[model samples]
Structure formats: C-alpha cells, structure tokens
Target: MDRSSGGRDRILRPVIRQFDLKDLPAIVEIDREVGGGYSPELFMTFHEYHPQTMLVAEAAGGVVGIVIGFKHTPLEGRIFWLAVKPAHQGRGIGRSLLSAILRIFSRLGAVSATLEVRIGNRRAQSLYASMGFVVDNVIPSYYSDGEAALIMRKIL
Candidate 1:
C-alpha cells in the first residue's frame, strides 16, 4: 500500500490489530492533530476496560490509526473515538478503523452502534451516513467548546 515510514521508500501495508500500550502516544498525537482533544485518562480508561475492542492500524512499524469503542450491552455498542494521522487521512484509514470496530461489534452480538460527530463536520457525518448510520438525535453543547453533536446510529 506504499506505506512509508520516516521518508524511506518501501512497500508497506498496515494491519488492523488490537491496541497496545506503545500505541497510546501515537493515538494522542493523532487526536490532537484532528482537534479531538480527548483527555489521556479517557483513552486509558477505554484501553483498560476493553483492550480488545480498541484497535490500531500499524504500517511501516508505526501506529497511524486508532479506534476506541466499548460494548455497552450485548445489544448495544458505542464508538467513543476514531482518528487517523493527518497524513494518513483520505487513504481509507478512518473507514478501515470504523469497519474493524463494526466487525467486532457484530461478533460480540451488538445489535446497534452509536456515535456523535460535530454538527459542522460534514465529512465525518457523510462518512457515518455512508456507513448506514442515520441521525438519531441532536446533543446540544455536546462538546467542551459548546458545539452541538449529531448522534448517529447503525443497526448492526
């Protein structure tokens, strides 16, 4: 897939795998770059609670994408966070992460999956919509910056 690490020219392919402690820093960095700004504690909590559900995409021996999700019940799941390195965006990393998480939810017998995206993030909203996630509700002031969020859900 032409994944190059540190300017080296080599054919690289990333595998979607479970998150590891070493991937934490990369996850935080990607979140900041994407303006997610979620606290480290939250990420740690997600990892500690459902380590298997958290996934990362590694190519050229570096973490480039991540998905943090939690299974709320046998029938419900929530995608808490997803981010891909800015340089890796538009390369299907985000889609891959989402698909991986959804696959896990299905295997775990989750009937539905839910998430919230900023109201103005048309790109993300479009991606979610394309994945069959319909807007289920609106959350006023859902973000710390007072940006409303659109709650989207997909029946898995």
Candidate 2:
C-alpha cells in the first residue's frame, strides 16, 4: 500500500518518516533480517551521529526497512547504513529510502554521496548503479567477517 495514496492494501502499507528512538526495535529487526545485525551501541551511535537524515519504512505493523545516514561536512558528502527486511525485498522501499537520502544531501549542498556495500551484495550494487552511483574503489576487509566492501559514489 502506498501511504501517500491512502490505498486499501495498506496491510503491507509503506510509510516514510524521520527516525525516532521508538523506532529502534524495528530498525534492529530490519538489520538482523538483512543479515547485518546491529548492536544497541551501534544503533545508538547511529542515532546520536545522524538523527535528522535517518528514515524508516514501516509495513505490516513493523519496521520493514531503515536508512541511517548523514552528511559529512568536511567532505560535503553523505554516507548511509541502509537495509531492508528479507521478506520485504524487491519492493521499491530501498529506492524510496535512497531517494529521501539524496534529497537530504541535496538540501545540504553536498557535492556527492558515498556508501560501501559488501562485494557479494549484487542486488545492492545494482540498486546503487541504477541510482547513478559509480564504483569508486574496493576497501579490503571492511567487514568484521573480513568481507571486502565496494565503495561507490554519486556526484550530485
């Protein structure tokens, strides 16, 4: 369901809004569902570091996806921690979240946006590529599991 449209199928309706402390559990669930669980410490770290730019997508009475991001003043760029629940994959949620983020970056006058994705996450790579991001480099051992990360960037 599209919250913007007030449709009836809202059973898995999509809503996009700023992050709140109350939304942490849903965020954590999405993180874990995506095989990228985040600790309370890390979750707090995310909120403390970037409150204004973060967004959550709620569907079926739970948080189905999340995008935690913020602008880096020195570099005038934005980076994010984005994930969606496995069951909710293939929907336009990720794109909506990314679009929201880019709007925030544009508002901040960021010249570019950057993010890192595990090399094996082709779906994510495809999403970024479709959104106009280019592969910038590979960062070795970027994950605790020793997975390398594909660094991508979008020049606004």
In order of appearance, the predictions have TM-scores of 0.87, 0.84
Q: What are the per-residue Cα lDDT tens digits for candidate 1 across 43-132? A: 888889998789999875689888989888879889988887877665666788898999999999899999989999988887799899
lDDT of 2 by residue, 1-156 (tens): 233744444234478888889988778777776767668678788788777678888776777888887777744566668887877766777888888888888887788899999999898999999999999999999989999999999988
Candidate 1 segments whose C-alpha is farther than 4 A from its true place = 1-13
In order, the Cα lDDT scores of the candidates are 0.85, 0.80
TM-score for candidate 2, please give it.
Answer: 0.84
What candidate 2 gets wrong by more than 4 Å, as runs, is 1-13
Q: What is the C-alpha local distance difference test score of candidate 2?
A: 0.80
Deviation (Å) of 104 in candidate 2: 0.6
Report the C-alpha displacement of residue 37, candidate 1, in angstroms: 1.3
* Clashes found in each candidate (C-alpha, N, C closer than 3 A): 0, 0
